[model samples]
Target: MNTPPNPAAGAASRIPEVATDASLVVPVIEEQAVVRREVVETGRVRLTKTVEEHPETLNFTLLHDEVQVERVPVNQFVADGATLPGVRYEGDTMIIPVVREVVVKRMLVVEELHITKHEVPTQESHQVVLRQEMVQVTREPLAPPTPGPPPAS
Candidate 1:
């Protein structure tokens, strides 16, 4: 088959082709995410403690101890060289023995003392001051941070 001549091929053949050794440089671009955290004060809390005193009247029962002593005469003779009796107690009364020496060189019982104790109760009133503690809580607002130089780019 017979082929026709192409016009674009003839024009490409007429242009002079130049030879060069120069290199081409291209820059690459990248994108990244940045994250940061900072501490900030919003408000403040305050605690207050106080003590209060109040006068009060108190009532109580008081106990008092009273002692009574009585002496009784007893004429009794004991054997010679007998030992003296010691003090003894009967219920709430305490008995003490008294002895004497006769002219016949014998021991004689003279008198005895009986002592008793009693407790008496009475009502009494007294004035007293009592202390109490009180607590109060309050919230305070904090001022914002002062303006400063802008961050570097």
Candidate 2:
């Protein structure tokens, strides 16, 4: 899927360096950078329906049997062209599947969340004890970039 970086492009775009500071080794700063995260939900048993086997007793499960689940979607019960019935369009959440545009302009979620961040500055040399942590601060999401049509050649 990825084309190799062109050798000609690499050679042509090389930065001209100033050979003033003739240091033997350049220092590299390293810190704990969280790359991948697995959001763990504790005791997350959503539905635990158990069927006990008994010969005499048969459970009558009366669901929407006549409802066309195969041909039609639950959200599209009123037909596509027909007017949408009582749809909630509040902020962040949207209903438009194809274009994926939000129906509601703004919906506010109010919650008190604790956050923590450790900023380490450059130090000549230092030592510290290792520690474990659980809770941290949540940052506000950044705005999405402007979308445009494909560039015409």
Candidate 3:
């Protein structure tokens, strides 16, 4: 028995003839598929910040001042109608009068406290889609033409 010709195999030769008769006999066979892209929640990416307080030790120095007083007695003869000097400097110390002959010297003592700030850096990783493309596949079979009465010769 002989088999019928395959349309797909002979389609190349018949393409011109098919084109000529396409307006009358063949319904314009066209297959159209919608192309669309959707963002799907395949999974999830989450960034969480956890705040935890911990005790930290800081070491450094700060300075402030305090004053001290010392007393010394000067037993010497006073001249007729003479007064002690109002202010005098000995090295870095300043001597000032409290009253007639009683004078005091000023000096400084320092106390300390420490304050410091620090910056700590950390690293972490998370999932991301840097670049993305989508593809859709569909299969549609051609419908056979409906039988109609022969055209006028």
Cα shift from native, residue 95, model 2 (Å) = 62
Candidate 2 vs candidate 3: the TM-score winner is 3
In order of lDDT, best first, we have: 1, 3, 2
Candidate 2 lDDT, 17-114, residue by residue in tens: 54687645658998976566555333322343444443343334332312111121233233445443432333423233212113553222222122
* lDDT of the candidates, in the order given: 0.88, 0.40, 0.46
Error of 2 at 146 (Å): 47
- RMSD (Å) per prediction: 10.7, 43.1, 19.5
Best by lDDT: 1
* Candidate 1 regions with alpha-carbon error over 4 angstroms: 1-40, 148-153
- lDDT for each residue of candidate 1 in 1-153, tens digit (9 for 90 to 100): 889989999998986554576555558999998877667788998999999999999999999999999999988887656677779999999999898888987878898899999999999999999999999999999988799996665
Evaluate residue 103 in candidate 2 and report its C-alpha lDDT on the 0 to 100 scale: 52
TM-score, cand. 3 vs. native: 0.29
lDDT of 3 by residue, 1-153 (tens): 799998897987766554554575556788988776666444434444444444444444444444444444434434545653345555545555333332333221121112222334444444443433444444454456567895554
Clashing pairs in 3: none
Q: Is candidate 1 or candidate 3 better by TM-score?
A: 1
